[model samples]
Target: MQWLKVIFAGFIEIIWVTGINTANSWWSWLFVLFVIALSFYLMISACKHLPVGTVYAVFVGIGAVGTVIVDIVFFGESFNIIKISLIILLVIGIMGLKLATEEGDE
Candidate 1:
């Protein structure tokens, strides 16, 4: 379904972003480029069924939150109060966007 496409697109974005940390060599960069291309393609497909604004907001929200989590877990990044607050804000924004789209549909 369309929702599945959106989720897959988000997953691709997360993978591409996480891969950036390991992309030191030229070959790694090439693989990262491929992932980025795939993420865009999937995002376009998601937008075809979902509202463009909603899809874009959700895509960015997921990517930001995922990146923060990955940084904390894998990169030993600090998880301060500010970082947690920002992640919460991202979730709220994603939910607000989805609610607005639902209202428009209704």
Candidate 2:
């Protein structure tokens, strides 16, 4: 359950990142700020049940990969071999971290 919450937090983080990047008006900025706070709150809540190290890495990794994919799809960013390889490596790392993290290892 906490793992799911952490992943949802990452989704919210992507919203904040993209919103801030493209925000041109005060209202949009406010929305981005709300999302930022919400994301942090969710991540912190999840960390209480899971190891901070594992949760933090998973949260950050999701945000990183998600943001990159969003940039490519919506921000007109181009994808290349290097970017693909790096994303794959990051996913593998995140998976490894999840596998290695034991309950109450915090």
Candidate 3:
């Protein structure tokens, strides 16, 4: 459940980051702000129960990997072997962090 919060926060992070790139109007900017707030709120909640360093690392990993995928799929960013390889490495690092820590450990 705590990990879920971190995952959701990471997902929200991706939305806000994309919004930062695409938002052009006042309302869109406001929406981005809202999403940012929600993402941080979720992160803070997760931090209360999990190791902050691990939680933050995983959260950022998700956001970074997801953002790149978003760019490739939606924004037509060029895909390359190096980008994909790095993404895979990042995913492995995230999983390793998850495995290294036990739930409820501070």
Candidate 4:
């Protein structure tokens, strides 16, 4: 379904972003570029079914939060209260947007 496509796109976005962190050499950068291109394609496909604004907002928001979590767990990045609070706000915003879009569809 459309939601499945959106979820898949989000997953692809995560892969692309994670690739950026692992890229240390030219070959790795090239791989990252390929993943980025694939992510873009998936995003475009998702937009075909979901509203552009909703899809883009959700995609970027989820990607950012997911990347931050990856950094915290894998790279030993700081996991302070402030950062966690901001992430919570971002989740709230994403949920609000989804609800608004659903209401508008009805």
Among these predictions, the greatest lDDT belongs to 3
Candidate 3 lDDT by residue in tens digits, 1-106: 9899999999999999999999999999999999999999999998999999999999999999999999999999999999999999999999999999975495
Q: Against the true structure, what is each candidate's TM-score? A: 0.87, 0.95, 0.96, 0.86
How many residue pairs collide in each prediction? 0, 0, 0, 0
lDDT: worst 10-residue window of model 1: 97-106
In model 2, the worst 10-residue window by lDDT is 97-106
Task: Report the C-alpha lDDT of model 4 over 2-76, residue by residue, as the tens digit.
Answer: 656666767777877888878899999998898788778877887877788888888888888888998899889
What lDDT tens digits, residue by residue, belong to model 1 across residues 77-102? 99899989989988998988887787
- Local accuracy of candidate 2 as per-residue lDDT tens digits, 2-91: 999899999898899899899999999999999999999999999888899989999999999999999999989999999989999999
**lDDT scores for all predictions?**
0.83, 0.92, 0.96, 0.82
Error of 2 at 42 (Å): 0.4
Candidate 3, pairs of clashing residues: none
Q: State which candidate, 3 or 4, has the greater lDDT.
A: 3
- Native-vs-model 4 lDDT? 0.82
RMSD, one per candidate, in order: 2.0, 1.1, 1.0, 2.0
Q: What TM-score, to 2 decimals, does candidate 2 have?
A: 0.95
> Candidate 3: where are CA atoms >4 Å away?
104-106
